[model samples]
Target: MNNARTSWLSRSPYWVLSMILHVAILGWLIWYGPVRNIMLERGKPKREALIRGKELEKVIEQMQRSVAEELEDRVTLLKNGQDRMATNFDTLNAHFQPFEENQKATALMRFEKYAAALKADQESLMQVLVQAKATKNFDIASKAGQEKVPVMISALDEVRRGVLLLSSDETIAQMHALAETALFKVEKPLRDIGSLLGRHRRLEREIQESKAQVKLLGSAMQASRDEHERVKKAYDELAAKRKAVLDQMQALRKVKPRNNDAINEANEVFKKLNEQYKTDRKPLSDANRKARDNKYQFDRVNKRLDECVKAFNGLNIQTKLPEYLQLAIDNLAEASALETQVIEQVLAATKDQADESASEVPAS
Candidate 1:
């Protein structure tokens, strides 16, 4: 027995050493394997990140440059319009010179003052617009300046009509009528665009509100469903317990006759539990009704949101607005050109009349 025990002890050390070596190898693999992979990954060159960052910066710069160029182009177009209007005023001023010979000077002087004021207002608006564009905050400044443009145009229309009244030439009257008609036609589409913009804003707000209502109603519905499930589970558990009690009472009554009081008490408890279960049905029903009602409201809000989105998309202004604006520009240019021609014609007629009068006068 001692020889057997000594042989077992002699093998145990080898077994322990083998186990220790295996555990040490496992620990080393577990700890150092991931560290080696991480070191390798860290050693790899990060050229992609540097390249991507440079590309992103270039894209940002390009976007900024494009925005600046677009703003500058719009400003230049506005500036050209202002210059054209100024030229029209200059034409009116020249034509007024001969008209003033007949004491029709007050109207011309009033027009000149208004033109100067319009020019000053336009310059200030342009400066505000330029600064706003630089900061990417042109909402108020842009609208203010834009609103002023139409007012100035209306004033110009009045001045043009006033000048036309001073001239009696049929050709001048015809040209003025044509220019005024074209301008009126242009104004119609602009007013339509403004109305469409207002409607779009209102529809956007309605959609946002409807979406919020849908979210809130959905949450309420979920809560109601959860409460309904809880009430149903609790009632079911109580009913199950009452069933078990009734089963035990039946067995007890069959086995013993002296325990009638206990049986009666169990029956009473079962009756009460059955009544409680019946009462619990009302809460489950209420929860279900609440959930259904909330779901219905959520559906309604979702429908409203969908309708608003459809209306917003139907505006299609992105596709049609530029065309309308171009047409307006073309009409305005034609009107301005026609007005200039009428002014020149009126000036020539006035000059010719003065020459005829001078020729008919006797020498003093």
Candidate 2:
């Protein structure tokens, strides 16, 4: 009997039994008065419980929506920041654009030409180093040249900047020294040029001021002439009026008895006018003399400016300047020679590497 029970129990589906037990528990809870009494003691009405459940669902939904909106705002801010970064990168790229082509051409023509051969040698050296590592050949692994080759080549490849295999810090320092020397050589000449330019500018400004002064004086002279003509016209009109009054008086005396008081008053007025005219004439003469003096001064200043300009134009700095620049040129030539020496060394090393590789190939 025990054996039969074990076989049946072993064949039974535990999932169906668990479902039946769960249903029985649920039925007991629904009909159980004690469970309902407990809920009532807790002060929760059945109808209010349903309403609270709906309210809780709404609050959860509101929370979810707020979280979603916050996330979306954060994403929008990130996207805008990313766009600004890209714009900044473009602006920075534009700022450096002028030098890019020349740099690329120089690298490609000079450094890149040797890069491929150097890379091949570096790879071969790395393989040798790996083999040596297994054999515990620390001597070969410790070789500075062999160890540096692979890492240096890999670094150059990662950066995509062409290699100058033989160039060393000393060579770069030498070039810098040469450049400094050239700058030192030309410094004095450059300062002299700057000083001359300043003087030339000051002279130009003075000439311009002189021209303005001449123009002002010419205008003043014209104004003085106009005033003199106006004074002369006024005096002529007064004299003519005096002559007409006298003639009228003479004619009236013949027709009737003369008015002596009118004649005497007219005579006195004419005398006064004549004296005033004479007084004004001296100023006219003074103005004419002053205008002539201004013209003479203008001419003298203009002549002086012309001579200064001629002297400045005739002066030659070219012969002296070339001597200064020639020193710089010589320094540049020396730097170039040093670079050429490095390039020759790299070429020779590359040739030796090629020959070694060729010899290492097996006869097939």
Candidate that scores best on lDDT = 1
**Best candidate per TM-score, number?**
1
Q: Which ten residues in a row have the lowest lDDT in candidate 1?
A: 136-145
Candidate 2's C-alpha runs over 4 A off are 1-266, 269-319, 352-364
TM-score of candidate 2 against the unseen true structure: 0.31
TM-scores, one per candidate: 0.57, 0.31
Which lDDT values do the candidates have, in the order given?
0.70, 0.58
**Candidate 2 residues 1-364, lDDT tens each?**
9999998888788867999999999999888837424343565556744458889999999999999999999999999999999999988877886676566446555564544454454455445445544564434433533344345445334223332333334554454345334323323433443455456667778778877877887777677667767766776777777677667656656654677777677677767766766786776677667767766776777787787677666544445434433443343344334434544554565456557756895534
